[model samples]
Target: MMYDVLIAPFVEFEFMRRALAGVLTLALGGAPVGVFLMLRRMSLVGDAMAHAILPGAAIGFLLSGLNLIAMTVGGLIAGFTVAILAGLVARMTELKEDASLAAFYLFSLALGVTIVSIRGTNIDLLHVLFGNVLALDDQTLLAIAINATVTMIVLALIWRPLVMECVDPLFLRSVSRAGAPAHLAFLALVVINLVNGFHALGTLLAVGLMVLPAGIARFWARDISTMMMVAVAAAIVSGYAGLVLSFFTKVPPGPAIILVTAFVYLASLLFGPVSGLLRQMFPGRHLEA
Candidate 1:
């Protein structure tokens, strides 16, 4: 009976299958973006953009009445718009990028909450924050698959130049067009993935999943490529484990999955065996030498 509750849902129900597929796609799409976000020092920017998607999603829900595609597109536009506006503001003012990001996300969160209060129920608000992954429909699953596939392809194509730009933007700028095209392309992919994953994980945990696994990978891995691979693997394992746990516990999958990933992150931080927190703190002890 315990196994039935834990594993049967995934094997037996269509909704569970869709939910798993959606999460797997999100994990893949987000892991690479997280690595790049870390490399570019734009991790907070991703968080802000995720929150910035909320108002647009609420508006889309009000206008179209639960049309997933329309809502996803609305959220994507809002997220990308905020990102671009923040960039412009950063260039125009003396404020740093982090400051600009904070402003954008705060504004977006306030606006989203206001709109949802006026137009939606408390459940709607909860959905925006935490999501309902077990209720994900076929349409959403299909969209997730498509978005993940395209995002992966685009990332593969531009990975080198984007990495170069992230590592040394000044040097790249001195060379040619400075990989601006690649940068733009990567940002576009980020928007798509954020929107695609929004309904499955919500803004708060979406950003968490995006950043934590990549961060954990950074502690144990030296090379960029290896770090990315490790991040993706970590994300996939944690996501699946979380989903299965949620199935058995009859809990909300989004937070459950995030908690699992968070545990993995904590483990990596505490005992990663290379530059883990314990090793760093002790300085004389070696977990694996």
Candidate 2:
């Protein structure tokens, strides 16, 4: 009776398994990306790239008739192209990195909306914004696994140089020629993780996944390695909690997960033992005193 009433709903459900898998994969890959993004001070780029994938996904849907894999591929290509163009524009002109990213993402957002409207397929625009995690299938799960593996491997290989560049770019550049390659490779991995994660979390919240936990971790730890580890642990725990909540409550997984993470961020912000808002706000009073 317990098996029929309780376990069956989650254990036998394909969508539930797929949604859990999606959450796990994205949290694992995105946690490190979040740390490096913080170090680079280019965290906004993740948000911009996430938005940039919209038009490509919409276009893919229009052409391929809603094949999620094909549409995701389209989004991935579009996202990478935007990143490349933004980098080139930033290099060739004086617009600066933030400005270039803004321009690219804004243009992509407009183009995506226009194309979807013209296609007249009755597809909801909000799906691209918030994502539909419950709709994830085996094929999408496989794609996410592949993307996660590649992202983790690349991150592991480039971890040291990336850290050096983040801390002391000039010194690293003066010391070794490999810093430039490491920087480029790291950006490439960010693009891939953002695109892959978009399948579950969409543009708005996917970027949040890459920023909020890391930001929260910074409040508690002084060491970069410790901060990354803490952020990953936080992400994995909150992700699972969100998935289970969504499964039981019939809420959308992406927003539910992000909302949970946001709560964690808020707690960290206000009460983290090291550099919390409360400590900063009331410098004189101590919890013991």
Candidate 3:
């Protein structure tokens, strides 16, 4: 019965196998980026960036009708443009970074919707907004895999300076010139992952696999490296369980996966070891000083 429930689906179906592979690669790149976003207190920026890519994706869809490369390039361009513009706006104006990002996010979302409406059907818009993971093709899968590889490699290259920037931006800037470049590289990584995610999870829900696992990891881990590991594991489990749930229940695969992460996040909130409600409610014995 367990085999029928768990193992049979992947073995019996190619789509299931493809979905699993796509999500595995997604998790590999996204989870660590998420952990760093949380560490830097920029979780919402991830969401903003997710929205920021939409207009470019919509434009790609308009121009080429769902070509993965076109949409990915569009998203990358749009994401980078907004990131840079928002930074400039914040630096030059009275508006804060968050406000600048929020403003651009709204504009991007509105523009994306308009462009999608201009040339695409409701179904196309739905597909763009909420991805269909079960529909991932070989080209899409390959793109996702390549994106994950690049994200992992770039992250490794920028790990030290990025971490230092996250922990102490001022100290990093004071001590080394790597700070600004590291920040830009990190932002580019975020954009790249979100662009790839747009293909698998759509623009709206793409940030789920990225940010949610990181949030869950916070409950169990106090260190960055351990938090990233936990987040990746959580993303993997959520991806598998979500696919299984979708198979049995007929829920949309993309949303199903994100909902599973949400459930896990709630569970972690209540029962996790670090700062969960249970830990707070039932305090441990104080250590003797």
Best by lDDT: 3
> What would the C-alpha RMSD of candidate 2 be, to one decimal place?
3.3
- lDDT for each residue of candidate 2 in 262-282, tens digit (9 for 90 to 100): 899999999987789898887
Per residue, candidate 1 scores C-alpha lDDT tens digits across 184-264 of 888888788888768788766668668888998987897888988899889888888888888778677898888898899
Over all chains combined, what TM-score does candidate 3 have?
Answer: 0.98
Best by TM-score: 3
What TM-score does structure 1 among the candidates reach? Answer: 0.92
lDDT for model 3: 0.94
What TM-score number comes out for model 2?
0.89
Models sorted by TM-score, best on top: 3, 1, 2
Q: Give the whole-model CA lDDT for all candidates, comma-separated.
A: 0.83, 0.80, 0.94
* TM-scores for all predictions: 0.92, 0.89, 0.98
Model 3 agreement with the true structure over 189-285: per-residue lDDT tens digits: 9999999889889999999999999999999999888999999999999999999999999799999999999999999999999999999999899
- Cα shift from native, residue 151, model 3 (Å): 0.9
Best-first order by lDDT: 3, 1, 2
Cα shift from native, residue 285, model 3 (Å)? 1.4
